[model samples]
Target: MPSTDDLGSVVDAAVRARLDDSGQACDAAERFIVADDLYDGFVEKFTAALLDRRSGAPLSSVAAAGTLARQVAAAVAAGATLHTEGERRGAHFPAGVLTGLTTEHATARQELSGPAAMVFRAAGEADALRIANDTPYALGWYVFTTDSARAGRVAGGIEAGMAFVNGVGAEDAELPFGGVKRSGSGREPGRPGIEEFVGKKLVRTVA
Candidate 1:
């Protein structure tokens, strides 16, 4: 993960994709696992970018906002550092970032269905992959690295259904959209996805 050539692009893409749909998308990135070499700088820049672009947009519902608020509080209570804007107001959930989270924390495994992200400092590529795959849910994963071989290796190692490398907005009807583990059981688009909702019955007519 430390092979990143452009932190600016990584930060930009991460912010846009994560905040898209008010950070409520099932595939939105909720956890950021940065290599120890680039963890602090990435966090500083990513947080600043998040705060700058955050629109204070209301979530899908008041209850949704309340749920996110509670999740953030629980993460903090679990010993994760929080950087957020004030507090929740109605359905508006402030974008925030949680740091100092280890794989042992319950918040590390839970999904934040709002404009909040958790960042973990990884020892290196192996640790980064470990952290990325630590959760039970594995819908989507993003990798930013300049090394082509490392990129391919990391992409293959990620435990998600879809792995986007060095970019975002890869979702399309042509691509199989789904996740492994607790995220879901089947695909929803592309070739394989078409079979997820269809039932087949054998009909034989003797001629």
Candidate 2:
């Protein structure tokens, strides 16, 4: 798992990259779930970025350019507020990182499509686990801790297709990638990836 220092650095990067002009693109902004006590800097940077009017071209050109843009636009129209950074209404919708969110909020229940984040605060590890498990979607899971054993425990406990313990940036082509519950039903890459296509047949003989 990413240690407190790594977590802090990631948040610090987010804080530093608060705007398009600040040399950080939307993708660079990692959707986070840091502790409430350790969120002062994250909140500041994320909020600032969310509210600021970003000025830059599309990330790609070949396909639909404003698909994500349209999604963000529609979300804003649907009464979602940018409480932290940037303007409430604008064409350039900077990444919306919504913190202080609870189970009552709709985003907490469903998967977010755009560059948005729903940060929830848990009282303890059990609370964090409960909160994490409460969601139906489990495409990917990120765990950050200094303890290797604790990381193993958390990683094993999480219901996800891919669980990266210490680092979020690590991805092995040989490793299986898939999700459980609603977010996933099949595996990708490695042996499991190949096995996903092979149909299992069981012949029952009555004797």
Q: Which one wins on TM-score?
A: 1
Report the Cα lDDT for candidate 2: 0.55
lDDT of 1 by residue, 35-105 (tens): 88888899999999998899667899999999888888888898889987777889998899999999999
Question: For candidate 1, what is the TM-score?
Answer: 0.93
TM-score of 2: 0.67
**lDDT by residue for model 2 over 132-168, one digit each (tens)?**
7777777676676777877787777776677776544
On lDDT, the candidate that comes out on top is 1
Model 1 misplaced stretches (Cα beyond 4 Å): 197-207
Model 2: CA > 4 A from native: 1-3, 12-31, 45-92, 199-207
